[model samples]
Each structure stands twice: as structure tokens, then as C-alpha cells.
Target: MLALEELAAKYIQKTERVLTLLKSVNVSVSPDEKKVYAVVDEAKRYLEDAKYYYEKKKFETSLVSVAYCEGLLDSLRMLGYVEFTW
Candidate 1:
């Protein structure tokens, strides 16, 4: 098992990478499409949660939050709801 500090550091790096991906992606949400907007918004929230948990030394929760963010982003990409450069 990894030490708590090591695990937390790894999670912080992951969260940073996910945030970078989000920054790199170009996602446009239509003002009229509430459903798609909600989905993207939820993903953004998860990203924020990941950072928050990572700062608090909750590596497991941070990893889970980043995973959820990635899932939402992938679904949006698959549905053609958002456009981004991979």
C-alpha cells in the first residue's frame, strides 16, 4: 500500500492532468439546451470536487471525482454535444 502522502501526491497530479485536459478541450454549450448544459456543468463540478478533495488529502475521493468528470466528458464527446481537440 502506498503511503498517504504518496497517494495524495499522485492524486493531485491526476487532478491537475484532468484540469489541463478540460482546459484544452473546446466545449460549447447551447443556451437553449438545458440537458446538455446540465451534463457539462456536472462534469465541471466534479473537476472542482477533485481538486477540493485532493487539497484535503482525500486521494480516493479525488480520484473518483476525476473519473466521473472524465466519464461525463467522454459521453458528451460521443453524443456530439461538445466539440474538442483530443
Candidate 2:
């Protein structure tokens, strides 16, 4: 339980940092701009959900949500849709 809590905290912090970095980034203007923004919006939503779950003491669910958010952000970066460092 302690380890889970610690891990969740770490991931939550990391996700928050990534979200902050994302805000300063501009998505390239291209045909996929709409789709890219949609994915970014979804990632933000997941981060919010993670925080909500964390506050509710649902560590596992919170971790999962944050992981999904991170994955989406990574995908965007990897695909060159947005530029940011993890």
C-alpha cells in the first residue's frame, strides 16, 4: 500500500509537469491539427480524472489515468505533433 501510494504520487507529479510543458507548446498547423488537438484535450481530461481519483483515495485508478495521459502526450511528441520534453 505504501509503495502504491508513493508510485502514484510520483506519476501524478510527472504527469502534471508534462501537462505544464504541453501548455507552452504549439501544435504544428497541418491537416491533422484538429485530430492532434483532440488527442491533447483527451489527455488533459485524463489528467484531471487522475487527480479526482487520487483525491478520492483511489490510487490504482489514479495511476492508470495518469499513465494513459502520459502515453497520449508521449505519442504526440513522438509523432512530432507537439514539441516538449518529458
Q: Which candidate ranks first by lDDT, i.e. highest?
A: 2
- Report model 1's TM-score to 2 decimal places: 0.64
Give the Cα RMSD of candidate 1. Answer: 4.3
Q: What is the per-residue lDDT of model 2 for residues 1-86, given as tens digits with 9 covering 90 to 100? A: 46767888888888888777775335554466778889989999999998899899899999999999999999878777777776
* Predicted structure 2, TM vs. truth: 0.85
RMSD of 2: 2.2
The candidate scoring highest on TM-score is 2
Provide the lDDT at 31 for model 1: 45
Model 1 error, position 71 (Å): 0.2
Candidate 2 residue pairs in backbone clash: none
Q: Which residue ranges in model 1 land beyond 4 Å of their true spot? A: 1-32
Q: For model 2, what is the C-alpha lDDT against the true structure?
A: 0.83
